[model samples]
Target: MMGDTGRRRRSGPRQAAWEFFGAELKNRREEADLTQAELGMRVFVSGGYIGQFEQAIRKPQLDVAQRLDHILQTDGFFERMWRKLIKDSPYADYFAAAAELEALATQICEFAPTVVPGLLQTAPYARAVTIATNPLAADEYVEEKVAARLERAHILKDATRPVYWAILHEGVLRLPVGGRATMAEQLDHIAALMRTRTVLVQVLPNEEGAHAALGGMMTLMEFEDAPPTAYAEALLSGNLLDDPALVKRVQATYDLIRAAALSPEASLALVESAAEDYRRCASTT
Candidate 1:
């Protein structure tokens, strides 16, 4: 019972697992009296790669894991842990950086042109969107994804949470998903969240033609420790940019877009009106 309580006192499962792996790696390397660069040389991996793994920021592949285990004299410890971590996160590479950034973000500003950002999406809406993306996503998979997305939303309610400013294109509200009932519910959810003061939602009307961010959806996250980063994603691939120059360019573009969008007060009114229209439509059918 005492040990169980001690384990419970440790951080959450994901954080705990990462810390455990990191501690083991650090301890083994130190006991071997090897610097990170020295270990990298022996393993034929980059020093940066070694540092990332030790910090648990990146998971290693099988070959890399085996090499680390052999070099650290841990005898397959790295391999087992790597496998477990991968099993726990299927889309790790795709979303891991974003998740880590979200967890520590002090401010998050987003511009979504076509669809509602994932953090603001309702469960039914998220599920419908995910299902439509992949015909092979079974009902259970869709449910799991929806659950994950909703769990991510908890960051907004966190006590010491970040300031979230989201600029959504009017098209998102106009496109009905899961039928009128679901759309109404989703709009109502957004309005309710806005009222809570945790979220600031601005709508970029279609009339604001040819905006600066005609590229795609972008989220700029500012952190307490590292430099700010900008995330841009399409259907197949995503990029995380930390270069100060590039980030400044994106930030300037986002500022312009924000300026062109409706004010928060007006945006909320528009969203509420849309919800009402959807409610009336639902009632008629």
Candidate 2:
């Protein structure tokens, strides 16, 4: 397995192109005598979001790009640029937008009922999950996926990283993902991060019964300048919600789930205990 050096590089020709796109957008908007907010209003996105696009911190979807092209009278230049850059995304089409926003968020809260969130997954655990989902996937594809996931995790290591919080269900700890040894390492990693005060974690016990956000996984993110957004994922597809009412409701559901979860200290104990159990099983085998 590759260490930090093996992390997928997000720079190169594509990075240069993204920067150019941002610069061109900014120049065109100025030439048109339009403020960022005015341009965003014509394109049906928030002014902050437009600024993010201009700064290359976030990517725009195809529809949004088309809108931008129309507003700027660029004769589909933005759309063409978007098409070329989009083909390089490692994430699924449904999740690419949310992933982009993740790097720009100031705070992130996740409710994970089945598996650990991607931002917290170790390489082994991430590889195991990827291969399980695509049993016939080629080795190159698996490695690419694992590398992409690890790259995403690197955001947590950044000095300006968001305040991250996660609530995991009891079953997430009990499930022996990647076998005992891998699970042991995974839990230990989480515990270690908690000890360093890098992240806050809580666990919802099985006895808690059903909850408002139990049926699916929810990720809520708050940005420094942009409006808040929420993402929900299921078997294959995911939805990113930006509407004020919808985001507020998702936030409320997350708050409810958090209230029902064990305290952070107790959750650490449970996670450490689970790691010990796996260590023993791994040793025996």
Candidate 3:
């Protein structure tokens, strides 16, 4: 019965379940005499974003769901739904635990030797990565994943201040994804964020070969009141390491990687020039 009957309506998620969830959110907020804007203010998302949550156009991460539950006094309804939602996502199985921590992280340090880190990915770049990684997935399913991947960055933009420090290998700049235009745009976006102090990016030059972090990507996240954890991911498998020893080793490796990387200023210059080169090539093509 809730299927699209008009141009404005968009179909997404498990229809009946999301409807139940969204309805309860609206009802509870109304019961508390709070507008969507007011609820969003408390929830640390935008008013329009709250509307999207109602329509299930976006899915909330576990921590965001908890925040919403606390703000709306929904008795863990959103958190319950978030659990189910995570079980149904198309991403690597082990990444969900890490994603939850990322939402609450006060600081994030990442070393990406192969590709752009997920949080800094643009829409086109993310879609390209997903399609390449999931070659057999249905179009609709892939779109769902792409949308979710983009949503992960919302935490960094929200009221909770998280310092993001990224160490990217020089190869990440040369290896083009989604073609030259998209890669160029992606680099420009990173530069813009750096200029605004939204993120700190350093590039590890190619000549720094045979380093401690030779392969794979890792992210170290820190919370205000919790011990830090590290996440490392391969093509289809990932691990969340919480043991203080393993995480400490990873953290030390990352520190060395940062030391080997170009300074932030030099990294920004390289990124800008590489982007310009890509843009030029794309224009010619």
Candidate 4:
């Protein structure tokens, strides 16, 4: 058996739910006499993925959970657990609250001053950044974070995913977060995302100096079914702002920041250039 580590054993209400979820899934699957591989085939995911679910290292998509509930004859048990898992905070309370809102947002406008936005981060880049922030973090904790961050990207595949708009500071392009190779891959991923037309990224040039959101980062989420919300972050802590006035203020500042940043086409050019620069550095070193 694997030792407790990473987000699997991370403490929080959400962590407990995930533990229970794994136990319940394991019991139900075994009672049905289905091996992990057998269950994976029925769910159309890999056996390894099923194992992750059983270990509570990763949570399944809602559709996946529903299908599992069906296959295991759990009668909506998985579905209910899935809901609780998503609604609960996976990170800090405020950060997780914003994440939950992001899942349902119709439009996600983000302003990142220091680094690449989490949703836009590649696996290596995300892992490196997480480790850098918490140098003492256990390897398992880091792996769990990488899993969670990558999982956020899955939202992009959803047909109903919100329009993703991000403005990145120029420093983000210059700083080599995970050294040359990782940063190269990171920039390549962002450039590719821009070409895909699902995301719009604008770069705030160093020449442009400071903008409306200079000291911190902000994510503004607009929802068709509910009131809009905003989140601000610095370091490990963040806040989810539900006040109408505060949300509006942040939205307006974002608009100003966007206006000051380079156009999407131009930003893509810079991103591509930065990627090549990293690749070049990697080759020489």
Candidate 5:
């Protein structure tokens, strides 16, 4: 686990490159049917070090990548890819950190009031929301952000990863993004995710009224080796709070809000009903 200062310092193209390289290395080793210990022997690194690199828990030096490429007989494949993969992605630095943390988290809980959380948004909804807020962003930039957000969903289905829980405001389901059809599809997607045992989806209805988190959306991420962190983002900026007191305060607020929300079963019914309403509206049009 990265220290708060280490996390702040390690956000950028360099980290992205390392994450990419780590994933690639893991894939290659598995394809070659080599254990971590065997791979470590070939690469001249310890098995524990190899495990850390694969988990993106540690960044490998350039020399390490070169050594691994030669020993693995990949002919500098990883080294060459590392140079090309470091180009800046459209996501903000904080978002990149959040993405990495989200991937590795043991559990995640989110409270969203305005819009659907990124992990649950459909492509069209995500694109429309991004373009509306970031009007100046290039088409490619919007696409990249949408793609990154959607990629986080993979963790939910990954058997080895942690469970995910999200609580969204009723208004999010009511908001008609990209038209009724798109909104219906988004609701359908959320409903589908709810069916997974590892995911819990709840909704705080408008009738619930004035809950503790009237402020804004926040995500609490708990990891195995590190203390929990709370992340909040706005139009152009984001803050990651690791101070124990602040995290606890935000977490307490989230707990209160979750208590006010409909139970998971009730939330599923609400989402399904809303989707039905959207479908009806779409049919009429």
Candidate 6:
């Protein structure tokens, strides 16, 4: 287990608050004379999950926090604290939990049918997407979101963890998000990461008609000590799924989509070619 100082150093001030929550949970659980597994069983989560929560390696959802209040007889203290902590999060309510899990994942596989995945987005592209969805949002709000998205990308710099794999539809390359120059820069960044072996990407070309996961974006995350989970997002809502049966189904769909994508080598060439075309177009403009 990492010390509080180490966790705070890596995750910053927000992490200190979560660490406080974890420490309190640990103290209360011990007072109740409950083993971590016993507490988890009562709360309907795994023992390992309870351990993660206590370590501040994962944050609990509202419902789980409420359950903790009930099981531990904390008089709603956990629930109230949870609401306060989540309210301060920069990510969308639907995405905050998933974003936390992304840091702890051992492997992440994403399928993007429209725009580039947030982890792969450049600042310009992220800003464009933010504005596209919230055209009336204040500039400060937009910049905050772009900064948060870019911060998530830093996980890739770790060099020794969370093997990232992404499959982007061909349309994602040609979307001209933020304009030709921005799209060119985005593609170039992805190509550079591919060349450095920082991430693996495959393109699901337009020619591969009617592929699986055509509905929206899906991410499957594998953890070192916990069961794998799947996340699917559409429009305004997102769902994180941990049920073994549901995760298995999500995994199967991802496998099918991966099968339909171009080989990594071919995909890199396609991405580079697309970037060149955008650069050419931008030069003319």
Task: Pick the lDDT winner.
Answer: 6
| Predicted candidate 4 versus true structure: per-residue lDDT over 58-86, tens digit per residue | 55667789999889888899998777665
Pairs in steric clash, model 5: none
Task: Give lDDT for model 3.
Answer: 0.79
The local distance difference test score of each candidate is 0.79, 0.86, 0.79, 0.80, 0.78, 0.89
Q: With candidate 1 superimposed using the best TM-score fit, by how many Å does residue 237's alpha carbon deviate from the native? A: 2.3
Clashes of each: 0, 0, 0, 0, 0, 0
Local lDDT at 10 for model 2: 31
Reference-based TM-score, model 5 = 0.70
lDDT of 1: 0.79
lDDT (Cα) of model 2: 0.86
Model 5 CA deviation exceeding 4 Å by range? 1-87
Residue 67, model 5: lDDT of 81
Clashing pairs in 3: none
Estimate candidate 6's alpha-carbon lDDT, on a 0 to 1 scale. 0.89
* Ranking, lDDT, top scorer first: 6, 2, 4, 3, 1, 5
Error in Å for residue 149 of model 6 = 1.1
Model 1 residue 95 CA deviation (Å) reads: 1.8
Which lDDT tens digits does candidate 6 get at residues 1-285? 644423433476777788799999999999999999999999998888888888887788888899999999999999999888777889998998888788778789999999999999999999999999999999999999999999999888874557999999999998899999999999999999999999999999998858944557999998665679899999988998887899999898888889999999999999999999999999998
Candidate 1 root-mean-square deviation in Å: 5.5
Task: Name the candidate that leads on TM-score.
Answer: 6
TM-score of each: 0.78, 0.87, 0.70, 0.69, 0.70, 0.92
* TM-score (C-alpha) between model 4 and the true structure: 0.69
